[model samples]
Structure formats: structure tokens, C-alpha cells
Target: MNKHDFKMGFILLLTLCIMPARAADINAGKSKAAVCAGCHGSAGVSNNPMWPTLAGQSSAYLEKQLKNFKAGLRENSTMSAIAKDLSDADMQNLAAYFASLPGKSAGGDAAFAAKGKEKAAMCMGCHGQELKGNGQFPKLAGQHPDYLAKQLHDFKSGERKSGQMNAISKTLSDDDIKALAEYLGAL
Candidate 1:
């Protein structure tokens, strides 16, 4: 082989060797997700308004959030502790399992949802037209209204930092946040 060909082949082999070999295992994820059932249901849904449902959320988004919590980029009393012990593979598996489940809606007030829809136009760019989410944006549709509102409040207060969300949340009034949450949750 030519010198250049040999060099290229070595680089490719090294790159492949450095990459992870295992794909995410949904069954393993389900087993690991047992601890989460208390708050995020066994099926990745949630009964309490205080907790956000994990079902049907983007796997990328779920993985990113778990990493964030582990790295201290995101702060939550419960999640931080839970994420601390998780390995990268564990996070990936959990994200995959949750994303595989179907999402449920908790219908909202028509008047509030109507008002919120208009305000949510700005969110469509990243969150998608149906608010189903794209890549790392997260599925806002069908989330608990209270959970959504709390996240918005945190973003506004700078407790949870996101360049776009922090700026957009700052522009929202209390009523606007409520309406937006109600609207998104109903979907």
C-alpha cells in the first residue's frame, strides 16, 4: 500500500476503535427506570402536575437533560442526585425507553389555550408546529401545565439558563406563562 493509504487506514481504524460499540438497550433501560416510577410513571407518564411526563419526549433531549443534571448545568434536587450515579450508557438507555412510550394529554381550558396558542408562535421554530419537539428541543406538548409553568418561571428567574428560553421567558407576564403552559399541556 502507498504511504498515504496506510496512514488513512490507520486513522480510520483508530477512530472506529475509539467509538462506543454498544447501542442503547430498551429492555435494560426499562429495568433501570424502575426507580423513576415514583414520580415519572412506570410507563414514562406522570400523574402529578409537579412532574413532567417523560413519555414520547425526544431521546436526545432526555439524554441531554440527564447529562446536564449530572454536570451541574441544570439543578433539581431530585434529578441531580439520581443523575449523579448514572453512566453515559445508562442515560442513553433511559432516554430511549422513555422516548419509545406514547404521550398522553391532560386537556386544558379552551379560553386559556386559545390565548396561549398565539403566544406560542415564537416557540414553533425550535419546538415544531405541533410542539412535538425536534432533536434536543424537547416535546412541550402534553406536558403538565404546572410543570411547564415552573420551568418557565425558572428560566425567567435565571435559575435554569438557556439563551433563548431565558430571553423569551423574561418577556412573559405571569398570566402569559400560565396561558402558554395550559396551551402546550393540552396538546
Candidate 2:
């Protein structure tokens, strides 16, 4: 899109920010989330450090991302394939299932956590307490290590280009991003 279209798109999308915390359907979500379990983990917590932990994430963010994946705006072969088959209700169900679960730490990996703490201080401005996130910011605490690292890289390199995230990530070093991702996943 051109600059004008980009601006209009962002404004329209932002205006439609759907953080319906109350609109989630946990029962339906449980069923839809089963499919998500393959990548996001059984309880929205992925064991794979490369995948992001989805537990405790904002339903709005999850829903939006699923939409983006399906629309091919956010390019990911795995997520796109998964999202392509989902309906709006299915997205809501999956979002509810993941959001309802309690977030778990990466567990038993403390050495890197300290470094992660320092890096995360910058992140807290948007991600909120415990990285549960607020508004448009996504939950980062207990997120997948690999997902976080990839996103950070994406933000810095312009593959991902949200105004705030891109700005925040630009200030980080590669090591800083790695440390933060590791720490956030363990939360």
C-alpha cells in the first residue's frame, strides 16, 4: 500500500481493535484450541522455545493475529495454514481457550533470566504487568522464546512494522533481544 493507504489502513484497523475480554466462549474455544495445541502447546504454553506461549495472551490480540494470518498480511506458513480454516467463532473459541489458561514459566532456566529482566524493562512500557499485556500490546510473559526472538528480529528489520513495537525493538541489540525472549518465555 502507498503511504496514504497505509495510514488509512492502520487507522481503520486500530479503530476496530477488538479486545472483547467478555465476548470469549471458553467451551467452544476448548475444542478449537485442540488444533492450536499442536503448535501452541496443550494449555497454550508451547514446550518449543521457537513457538510463542499463548497462555494468558489478550484475546483481542490473538483474534487479530489469526485474522492477519488468514488474510496473508502477517506471513507465516504454519499459522496461515492453521488460520485459513478457522471461522470467526472458531477464532474466538481458540482465543478464549488460550487466554483462560494460566501462564507458566519456561521453568528451571534462571541463568539467562537475569539478563532477560534487564532487557524486558524496556518492554514493560507496553506489555504491562507480568506481560499480560493491555489494549493492542500482546502478552509476553510465558511467551514462546523462539516466537519472541523472531518477532523482535522482525520488528527491528521491518518485517513486522507496528509503530510502537518497531520503535521499541530498534533499541535492542541481538543479545538483548535473545535475553528478553528467554526471560519472557520463562515468566
Candidate 3:
């Protein structure tokens, strides 16, 4: 090969070696996630109405939340403490394992769901037409109404801060929050 071609090949090889590989291991994630089974369930679904289900959530979203908790950007007593000890790879693995599972429906009140559908129109821009989530947005469908409502309340009250959520939640009343939660959870 010419000297120029040899130099280019060497540079490419060096660049490839310097870059970090980000492939997550699902089995490793499952092993690491055993501690989460108490609340998040063995399959990433939560039976309790208060805890949000992790199943089928986007890996990117899950990883971000874990990072947020670890950094204190998001606050949860249990999660923060747990996340504090996790490495970035641990978070990625856990997110991958959970995202690989199937999500379950929490069901909803018909009347409340009807009202919620109207409000969800504005949410589609970020959350997707089906509310299954986009890049970092979470899947609202099949989530628990109580958990969804609490998040909305937190956003409205400034307990949880998100540029979009905080502003949008401010426009909602208690009943609106409930209706939205019911509608989203049933999907």
C-alpha cells in the first residue's frame, strides 16, 4: 500500500480502539435487577398503584432517569440511594433488560379516560401519537393511573421540574390530572 493509505489505515485503527463500546448486556442487567424485583416486579411490571412500571419503557429514558436519580436531579429516597452505587453500565443494562419486557395495562375509568383523551392531544407532540413515548419521553400507555397522577401533581406543584411538564401540568386542575392519568394508563 502507498504511505498515505497506510497512514490513513493506522489512524482509523487508532480511532476505533479509542472509542468506547456501549452495547448493554441483558443477562447482566437481569442479575443486577434482582434487587428491583420487590417494587418493580420480576418482569419490570409493578403491582402497586404507586410505583411506576418499568416494563417496555425505552432504554434511553430509563437510563436517563437512573442517571438523574444518581445525580440528584430526580429525587426518590429508595431510587436515589440505589442509583448512587450504580455505574453507567449498570444503568444501561438495567434499562435494556426492562425495556425488553412486555408492559401491562393498568386499566382506567371510562368517564375519566374520555376526558383525558382530549387533553392528551397536546401531549402527542413529544409523547408520540400513541403516547408510547419518543426518544426520552416515557410510555404513558399501560402505566398506573396513581403513579401518573402523582407525577403530574409533582410537576404542577414544582416538586418535580421539567421545562415542558411543569408548564403543561400547571394548566391542569386536580380533576384534569386524574382524567389524564386514567386515559393514559388505560392505553
In angstroms, what RMSD does candidate 1 have relative to the true structure? Answer: 2.8
Model 3 whole-model lDDT (C-alpha atoms): 0.95
Per-residue lDDT over 78-187 for candidate 1, one digit per residue giving the tens place of the 0 to 100 score: 99999999999999999999999999996777789888999999999999999998999999999999999999999999989999999999999999999999999999
Candidate 1: minimum summed lDDT over ten consecutive residues — where? Answer: 106-115
lDDT of each: 0.94, 0.82, 0.95
lDDT tens digits, residues 44-95, model 3?
Answer: 9999999999999999999999999999999999999999999999999999
Q: Model 3, poorest ten-residue lDDT window? A: 126-135
The backbone clash count of each candidate, in order, is: 0, 7, 0
RMSD of each: 2.8, 8.6, 3.5
- Give lDDT for model 2: 0.82
Predicted candidate 2 versus true structure: per-residue lDDT over 1-187, tens digit per residue:
7999999999888877854444768998897777778877888878787788888888888889999999998988999999999999888878877778888777424677778887777777777866778765798777667778899999999998688888888998998888888888777
Model 2, which residues run further than 4 Å from truth?
A: 1-22
Better of 1 and 3 by lDDT: 3
What is candidate 1's TM-score against the reference?
Answer: 0.91
Please state the error at residue 134 of candidate 1 in Å: 0.5
